[model samples]
Target: MKSLNKVLLGSATLLAAITLAACGKSSSDSTTSDSKTVSGTVKLWVDTTKVPYYKTIVKDFNKEYPDVKVTVTQSPNGSANAKTDVGKDPSKAADVFEVANDQLGSMANQGYINPLSPAATKAVKKNNVAVASEAVTWDGKMYGYPTSQQAQTLYYNKAKLSADDVKTWAGLTAKGVVATDFTNAYNFYPVFLSAGTYLYGKNGETLKGTDANTAAGVAAMTWFAQQKSNKGVMQTSNALNQLKSGNAAATLDGPWDSANIKKILGDDFAVAPYPTINVGGKDVQMQAFLGVGCFAVNSNTATKNQKAAATLAQYVTNKKSQLVVYKHSGAIPVDKAAQASSTVASDPVAKAVITMSQEGYSTIMPKMTQMATFWNLSAPLINGAYTGSIPAAQYQAKLDTFVSAISKAN
Candidate 1:
């Protein structure tokens, strides 16, 4: 992995340098190395899970722009006061912070972020699409640049079903081979969504909890309960391992798993968009939670520093960097032009992921008070239902009511 990271960096040295140097600083400072050099450091906070990828990006960035140093800090996502620590002290805050997009709305509302000015708007708009930019905008204001895209997909072992064989859920089930990481929040949502059910509804512009207790919704939930037998027959494990090995015939997953599938299953893998269902005579699409790892400017910073932070954010998410992100990291490039490359379209793994991303829509991950606690409760509850210990009708009634009450208060 280290050698692969270095190879990617060396291949793109000049491009990385040009990108980092162009992001202006919010304040002017003297540089002893060269008078014309930009002089300032950008403190970046990233989730520790992503440190491996970011380290390479940072190393290559530093080589090109020695005048602009980036201090990369890793903080665990589980830290109790992580957000509070950054929110309270500008001195301790990262000039660029990457958090889940569901948290972006509340944080931006709290005055924690600086709004993207016209320059950023132009830069991102030219490179990305409205769907890719979804998470970065709140209340009509753009605040972040999208880092990657995800969509639910039905990944199958080509040995089991060709592209022509398993096109629908019935075909999938008839094969008596289907599995999922029934434990994960994002991956399981597709099973429910494929049955024409949803956790929330948009009443005009406002999002409201609805349809969770409806007949169709309960039936969808029941289908998942029935899948436990299928799970056992298919030899289920965690989605990563299950899909990586060719033991499981099919599993629902996101674009992030594309490379791992290739690494594990080799040439025997294929992916297709999850099937749809008719709701009220209209075909409603499944909505997964979309998020962005954005470069955020600290609002508390001096104006000059803030401006520079914005520039860095823009450059890092530009077409060139996005290409690197797509090629090496296996992340879907936010830049639409990057998708047009023959390399992206011709590569089997990338082709499957790009197709899924293009057709997908996303819901915001829940971030209100007690939301994490609710997840704690929901995971086991949902798992128990999937494993058939809990009856679907009874479980749905209890779970829906509990979640509704929690949503109201939180």
Candidate 2:
């Protein structure tokens, strides 16, 4: 089993963020962490499906800081749409809310969220996965309290294909059908990374550092076009349905849907890190975009309640609460201790997620504000290539256009 807890902290970027956060601690915090006498009425927004379990977690939090009253409610839109929901009106948003790491940069810049207090940031860095800390950091400040790490892995039916067959794309397809969606940029855009190119550069902060317009980018686009004719690959909007019906022997998915798949595949259920695929005549590990889910404190919270709000954010993401979340929702915990617990370490699903979250198998989704623009452009480009609507001759031109648009001032 691949363990998420044992990550090397060697990145200069992550170090710089940690240093700047520590230095910022000398100044007065935007929010205080005085839990003892802190008092406030703070609201927390979580995904609708998560409200119940989170409410139970809130019970645990209130025991520590009874003076703070917290109301756990469902977000009007889910955490996936947090940026949009919060953007509609920041003042009206929850005092503490859930958000994906990719949105942290834009939210921090737009003043929708406050940087985590130094004490909170320090605890986060010390307690979570190295990449989890890095995920919430933007402009050298920690913007959120990370809760879970995510990456898609290959889920297969062991009855139809052996474990060895699923390790290589060619072998899986040759033996049984694999269903997936090319329309999801989330599903296929990592082909560019697998093909050997950077999405916002090595550190993912440089705008022009994106080189999807280069030869490597063209190669990735070409691979997408080639898949349209691959007999073994089935393109479907609902890959899960295909797998459920036995039309597809395998599908790529994350931990969120594990329960449903387990129910469907029963004893035959199996999962593993993505298989190797031949791109540009060389077999390379297929990659997925890794993501971290975090809870951010609103910058718009009442000044009197700042400490209370910060306390709530910190409480729900602590190691014990993270394990609770993992048990109830299958959100793979980013907490180092939680990941190392027997419950997580021995779980097959967690092992696959931890393996895929590593250097060669995945890329952490970049936390650039311009990511909004990249998402708008990436999906259509990938879909067009897969459907051959963009044509083979225009692969370079299409990629060039995409890189140029996203590289502009953010």
Q: What overall lDDT goes with each candidate model? A: 0.53, 0.81
Per-residue CA lDDT of model 1 for 42-110, tens digit only, reads 776765545666666767655655566777677533222335656677556777766544455556666
CA deviation > 4 Å runs, candidate 1:
1-39, 47-67, 75-90, 196-200, 203-207, 231-235, 239-246, 276-288, 302-304, 358-374, 393-396
The Cα error of candidate 2 at residue 28, in Å, is 6.1
- In the range 1-410, model 2's lDDT, one tens digit per residue, is 01111110000111111111111224344534332666788899998888999999889777766778999999887787788898898788898898888888888778777676566677778888788888888888888888888898999999999999999999999999999988888888999999999988887878888998888888888888888888879999888899999999999888888888999899999999999988888899999888888888777777677767777777788888888888988889888878899999999999999999888999988988787788789989999999989997898888888999999986
Minimum summed lDDT over a 10-residue window in model 1 is located at 4-13
TM-score: model 2 vs. ground truth:
0.91
